[model samples]
Target: MSARVPRVLAIAGTDPTGGAGQHADLKSIAAMGGYGMSAVTALVAQNTEGVRSVHVPPADFLTAQLDAVSDDVEIDAVKIGMLGSVPVIEAVAGWLGRHRPPVVVLDPVMVATSGGRLLEPDAEDALRAVLGLADLVTPNLQELAVLAGDALASSWEEALAQGHRVAREHGTLVLVKGGHLAGDRTPDALVGPESPEPLVAFDGARVPTDNSHGTGCSLSSALATLQVRHGDWARSLRIARGWLRGALERSAELEVGHGSGPVHHFHHVQEALETWGTVPERFSDELWEVSAPVRREIEELEFVRRLGDGGLEPERFLAYLDQDLQYLDGYSRALAALAARAPAEEARSFFAAGAVSCTETEAQLHRARLRHAGLEGAGAPAGEVTRRYTTFLLAATAAEPYPVGLAAVLPCYWVYADVGRHLQELARRSDAAAHPYADWLATYADEGFQEATRTARRLLDQAARDAGPAVRERMREVFLEACALERDFFAAPAAASRLPGVVAIEYS
Candidate 1:
């Protein structure tokens, strides 16, 4: 809870253009509220126009630079950008092997925006060998094609398969960016060997701008900060991608460079927004009124206890899962409906991913409950239903080109933790049959899940500080509905506890 700054180490080539590379990465880290440290791999004399000259740092010096930063500073995350040749890659890989940092983001930068090559002939092999130690690797379409020895992915399925293949081979997570593919829209896939499926994509509209010079470097750096702040690299990528989208949107009006220019890295920074919380320039009484119930419910919900104990009871879990499946179905439909408004292909793809996830989760839940008698045949696709709510909330987010999708996801995190705590307290004094909450406490109690729950809230709150009041107000709206849904979800047994249908004391 203490106010502290996160420090990220960016190891990459520097661009005089300041649009992409080490320079852009540093700016992105700072812009996202993290302190940035750099170990230059190469220095390029490049402008928005393109690269003119490149200067490589000797392997030994690169080694010294990496060592000095790790020894002197408390590094939270590391972002690897362009490395000119094999020696530089080996030096970085050697240093990283020794340090064994927890969060390392490897951004494969081989093809530049101007169709210029940045790495030496042997650099690819060396870079791959050195970067085998990365926690995550982000590669654009061209890089993926090169890595796969295929000129094009041929299909979205191929892109995902290739990304997963490389991620597994490297023993790290792979983020395959579809932006460079020929299309008005692009989709990116994030996959690892450990996940359940390779198709769980983070779809976003690939922002169209010639000013997208430093995108890869900036994204990796931003992801590094999120990784540092929160251990999950997936969340970091989601945030970074969304943050980059905002940066691109804001920079569309600025004339930073004559050719490709730079994105507005400082876009979400709300220091310039005159209004703070509590005192809004355009305050609405309706907003406060609608949000009051949610605030009260949140105050009443005991998140810690719900997480600590058995969480949701078997029956309640079944019910909640059913409802969630229903929600996701609606959400998928909503996403499809909203696709026409998507600013880029990535957003449309992300919505598709969300739908796919919802459907898959619904199937998983349905199978999980198949053994149970009364609930076996009657379950609704609840995740789909939840999707409706998400899509409705997303509608409020449509006017702006930001990561409102991630924002819409916040309620799921905040509400569950809060309601789980409250639910757990009720479970503590009651027997299994008497309590409505069960499987949830065990589910939420896991250290990994708990950490995720906490980090997401912190990130969301930070996002709110700079978001427009309308957005904040919309967040409150969705949160209120979330509270109601949760309350209704729990209200079933609590309200009908004494009824014979409730079937109390059945646990023999």
Candidate 2:
């Protein structure tokens, strides 16, 4: 009855301590929603105390494991943790070239929590051999220093410098985790030229806890999940960091291993499973009723048929968009929150794309605002319109869907595309001489708006294709609700009730 999910594979050393390596990666992956597969490089003998010994797997055995996973299951993305030995590293590197999964996330685990070396001294060369093949490589302060070679990371500035260097040198993005930096906020820098500026700094509230045994593995695995599911770097890093923070917060009180404890990977899932038949997601009946009304209007309206006729108009369309953009911005923020709560990489990436989508829509709305001609007053609409839209956003923000929370944003995209096309006849016939009227044509006529609309259509199509029929249906309901709200706002029954002019502000 549940939907099919993305698949992810994790390859790395095993930390029996459960704090730092492949175990952390797998746990992070599953918490996100993707089916998880794994290949072991080595085994660690340790607990909450320290690593006593390590049993490095044979290079041939490592190959067989990688082959077994990649040969059988469809691995959407991959996260690599510690290799433990030169042979292990080489084995993984060789398989990486052969499989070439969509995304490869690497956590360059050269050192451990107790200041021990998980990688052999000569293993650095082997690690570098495969570093360039990754989509991303995550490194902490010490590992970064080692990977960058001797003189490259003598100071914090040098460490930051090496992060950029690593990405450029390897043709792979690098996430330089700055949790070790003495600061009030823990910041991790996502570096790659394809992204904005020098880096996208992901900041998280620093939780003072020593249970961070497998943090490197956890973070990289989380990022890999996002990259695999969403294909966005900045979004992935942002979500991955948030998920790791949540695990740290919740697992702070848990004590399992003697050395470093594992995160509470299934906290939310376990809670729900415990409460399973007794209590479903809150307000189930209400969701059905609230969702149904919008669907009814959509079914009755021939929106999709009109879109096929190419008769869609612009100004009226733009009016609905301003509110929708506002809504998307809030949805993106919610995705960020959901990502924070992710227990695994696959789950984090799911929301990561939503965040990217949020900003993408916001950008279009910003461009549309320029057409509003000056802070020139256009007469205010009713207070209720503003209140309603704001209320919708606030409600989503407070919801607990977490990574899956991105689902809330789906309604706007699919519904609008469906409804807009249907109103093509109205769009062409409507008078363009009025206030919102002139604004609508101007907004839709612009190249940016056209492109934005196309993107929304494409994204929604992708979602429909990827999501299960049930989830798709839910998304459709949400989209219909948004369309209904737009209709209500634009088709205000009383023309005399129109308030004062709205002053349009220029975009910066």
Candidate 3:
């Protein structure tokens, strides 16, 4: 017999557009790997833009719906959203008092994204009272302000302050969302009275998009599902936030409506179809195949080609080498983290050796090259590209599971080996001139490097083979992203030198 999955129920209103309310909650719950059930409190006549009207179900019927779900089904978690009126909030609150689920996430959905009021003004008191039943409450700045009985938060600090007040007053955990803040990064924090600082904080680089209509609903529901699945709030929040960020990043690809569209919950599935055309029979064999474009771009780079034939400028080569050393600092940390998280002793030892190689072997190679170039004790500062790439790698290793983290760091070893071998072959065909980059090319083409690359591939393949479909798909995404970043890393010096004045703006 199959094991039972966590059953998550959403007690919320309906959005006909399917972008918010019960629709979004159910979609989010299922997307986060839960069996979702819903008890509708109201029917919202709305689209992606805003709500036009809401039709409230009778308090007694809402109670009946709650009883119907609790009577037969065992609910692992519950997400409560958009209590339309005092009667409805009271009914749901009363139900919560009796049938207390293991996890209760209340999304205090008051003001909509488009500045429409979702709950009645009088129901604010009822909502406040309802918070006692919730283990966690997710509230954006506006909702947080209302819950705190304060004006709209003018800053992120104010929002966090409001969240603390509400959490302390209700004796519940509060997730303060910073998406509404006008900034490049969206930071969320989990606050409770048990700690002076936030219990947990997830800082995310904001995906600049208008398709954030149902983000509040989705986050709360996803947290509920993940809570049921993992039973750890911090870990669940990290995974949920990662999934949400990915959804927001790809939301623009969806053309749901003219207004702010709903987030693409299944973007990963759509992406695989768009990218691979037909799903590869084996992801392991086709890993490098999928990265063909990046490899081609790297091969065609002027600096790369010139280095192969010993025609690259010494200054440019020195700059690349210095930036590489800076990158190694972060890379070494990522490798060490991967080693610590590896399930098998083989993987653990391999990644641990990799970490040592970066700090010791690679460091010696870089210092020798810099000294040969008459640049001893002189190093180039970390460029924007190097920082961005290394930052992504470090974050991936820290936030993701061992398998996902392994996928992220694999491309650096494999891609460099492939590029080095190609360059080494090109250098061999050319006349035996004393090339400035000869040592660099030789190191990459070395048998030890090749062996390391092979080991990386084997580890990734084993992990992918053992992982479930969802994790395997995540591995594909991290692999693809890391490969793309590897190409960017190779082409960084050229891009920066070529476009000295022009800034490159990357969204994801």
Instruction: Give per-model TM-scores.
Output: 0.53, 0.53, 0.55
**Each candidate's lDDT (Cα)?**
0.66, 0.62, 0.84
Off by over 4 Å in 2: 1-4, 150-156, 193-197, 270-277, 280-508
Residue-level lDDT tens digits of model 3 in 1-508: 1135779999998888888889999989888878999999988888877788889978999999999999999999999998979999989888988999999999988878866788999888888887878999998887888889999998887888888898888999999999888888899999995653788887877898999989999999999998877778888899889999988989888788878888988765675565444445456677777778888989998878888888876656666777788888889999998998999999999999999999998977787876765665225456777888888888888888888999899889888888898898889877856776787788888898899988988888777766667877788888889888787777776643421222341211
Error of 1 at 497 (Å): 67
Per-residue CA lDDT of model 1 for 206-241, tens digit only, reads: 676777878888888888887777776666667787
Native-structure RMSD, model 2: 17.6
Choose the strongest candidate by lDDT.
3
The ten-residue window of minimal lDDT in model 1 covers 493-502
Order the numbered candidates by lDDT, best leading: 3, 1, 2
In the range 44-89, model 2's lDDT, one tens digit per residue, is 7766677688888679998998898877887888888878787787
What lDDT would candidate 2 get against the real structure? 0.62
Candidate 3, clashing residue pairs?
A: none
The candidate, 1 or 3, that scores higher on TM-score is 3
